[model samples]
Target: MRPYRSVLYIPAARERALEKAQTLPVDAIIFDLEDAVAADEKENARVLLARVLGEADYGGRARIVRVNGLDTPWGAEDIAAFRGAKIDALLIPKVGSAADVEAVARLIPDVPLWAMMETPAGMLNAAEIAAHPRLSGMVMGTNDLAKEIGARFRPDRLPMLTGLQLCLLAARAHRRIAIDGVYNAFKDDEGLRAECRQGRDMGFDGKTLIHPAQLAIANEEFAPSDAEVDLARRQIEAFDAARREGQGVAVVDGRIVENLHAATARQIIARAEAIAERAI
Candidate 1:
């Protein structure tokens, strides 16, 4: 899990995105080597990732390389170059089954894999893919998935939740992170914020981002809200007082407080406090 609460994407270009990464407020950076880089620039991108990974500590932000799929020409070299580069995770594109994940795991036994749930096969095999030991999480590539399956986008994403929840359930089953896909409307700040909130409500750890403009909103949406934090603190204090009294549960704001609620409160407080710690 690595204690990540928010992640932002940086396009693959040694010149353009590198300078940007040094300034952004994000928990992790997905240095894009797959879709963002031109075919001709992939080699340069690989070199850039290696150099970036080797040189900088990334300001506490986890560095990830989004490699091309194993079936592509650049994929093999991407893996070969990135394995020893100190990346926190290897983002594998278009993973269909646990076998696909296992194959990559065999190649890089130590690095964790983030499976892309993009195609039909991927959605169908989501559970199996998440079952792999090296599978650290699933990221939805919704644009590609929609194109591949001809799924229409909705105002509320009702059409996509089945696939999205499939990935979420699998990740939860394996105790892995589930991240939402990039919201394509980068220019529309309101839309981006709405999508981020939607993804968070859907139980995603955080949404994948395509632009630096989306960073602040993603971080805001993913972090515990003031109301939530206050509630969590109250729950924790109430439960602690109850435990001191040898009570298993206690009333909190007229609600029946139980251990499950206490556990959630503890997690929320920890995450909120962690976020505050990072800010300091």
Candidate 2:
């Protein structure tokens, strides 16, 4: 959850793609064992994924595995194979409630869990799913959610707004990271930029990307601007000064800056620092 400005998905079945991911600038890499892999390639993909993970040096990128659900024949093997694997978190697909999280949590109690909020049921029980002790973050499965809800894809994402906000609220309420869904038009830079801006405006921590092409845009859009970083520094300084003076609040740029705003500013600075550290 350390400022995942661009979380890229790499098909676990493709060794070349996995090798290529080592050089990408993505904040996180989802070694996909689900949708990206074919049914016939499940076992081989899991084996290859484990080998790559064991042998490769991913630098600062967060390595997360997107495993198939328990309902699938290969799901159990997928989970078992990753029991002691080197990974940041195990992403469980179609997590509808706390029980779904618990089901996988039982297998790998030590590893952090990430849930996919794609179903209507998952949306309704988002708070419960997010409250799980092992749960670290939630990823919006917009494509699956749209298909399940039979909603058409809109450029403005008017249809998915409620679901997106609900998931974000639940994640924030529980102190967990919430990532926005992918922009389907990976080649449409303008559309991707607009969507990344919208996601940032709506309070998403970062975005789940399908292609490497989307990384730069997501990283740029989600990062705080120069003006914002400067304001955050000023707010923190002013707030500290007001506190020393026995004042309850401080004024910054003609607005009342309270401890709450200062707290948010600190987080922004910390996020910026985390991003910088990853780059180094």
Candidate 3:
């Protein structure tokens, strides 16, 4: 799995934001042309993003462009503008079903696709959407989902739990990355940290950000902690020793360690390595 701890969203229309993004320490950057760019500025945003893709050097960070939906007048043109451009993925907004993935997949060949899981239909058909061959990731669109379901926003995201899990299950089942929704209160570091921890605990690979300030919190929360890494290493060592001794189980910190536990520990260690490598 990719280390997508912090994915920042930058309006594709903002030249300064696009340029400044090269210096930000983010795992990925979503060049948003959907809600972030005004309808009147859609064409200009597309042109600007295409130019940025050609000229800018984002350096190991994944570049994803969120285009307007095909139902909109600007959607086709948005796809057309980025043809052959160097972007890692195309994020389709308001994805309702597998057919929605296919619709965009047909137009953007050789590019991985990401779906926004926001609407009721999208959540209901998440399994099918995730099964699409070209699909690589899913981003939870909690704000739009709240509006669609008339759900009241709570810090715990009690109302959005079902949808979040549904999408996450599908993404994991299909080996695709699942990113948590953005916190609306960008300035509230405590609120953002709480939400990031919740998302990470709930099994989201990462959280999307509306502002760069949220990057540090998201990155810190999603990463494997030093204590966790140390524990994982110890668990792996104990389990390997037990296996060599023809034993099926080992004890770590007075708790039983088995093959399953060792496997999880290895994954944690590998994830930590991946994050470190990306940083360098």
Return the top candidate by TM-score.
3
Superposed on all Cα atoms, model 1 deviates from the true structure by an RMSD in Å of 1.6
lDDT of each: 0.83, 0.93, 0.94
For each candidate in turn, the TM-score is 0.94, 0.97, 0.99
Candidate 1 clash figure, as a count:
0
Segments in model 3 whose C-alpha atoms lie over 4 Å from true places: none
Per-residue lDDT of 1-280 in model 1, one digit per residue for the tens?
2445567777777665776687778888888889888999988888877887788657767777889878889888888887766878999988989998887887887788898899889988899999998888788889898888787877587777788889989999999888898888889889888888888888888888877787888888888899999999899899889999999998989997889999998888888877877771
Q: Taking the tens digit of each residue's C-alpha lDDT, what string does model 3 give over 133-242?
A: 99999999999999999998788899989999999999999999999999999899999999999999999999999999899999999999999999999999999999
Better of 1 and 3 by lDDT: 3
Error of 3 at 220 (Å): 0.3
What ranges in model 2 sit over 4 Å off?
none
- How many pairs of residues in model 2 come into backbone collision? 0
Instruction: Tell me the tens digit of each residue's lDDT in model 2 across 1-280.
Output: 2778889999999999999999998989899999999999999999999999999999888899999999999888899999889999999999999999999999987789999999999999999999999999999999999998999989999988999999999999999988999998899999999999999999988999999998999999999888889999999999999999999899999999998999999988998888887782
Write the number of the candidate with greater lDDT, choosing between 1 and 2.
Answer: 2
lDDT, residue 190, model 1: 90
Residue 168 CA error for candidate 1 (Å)?
0.3
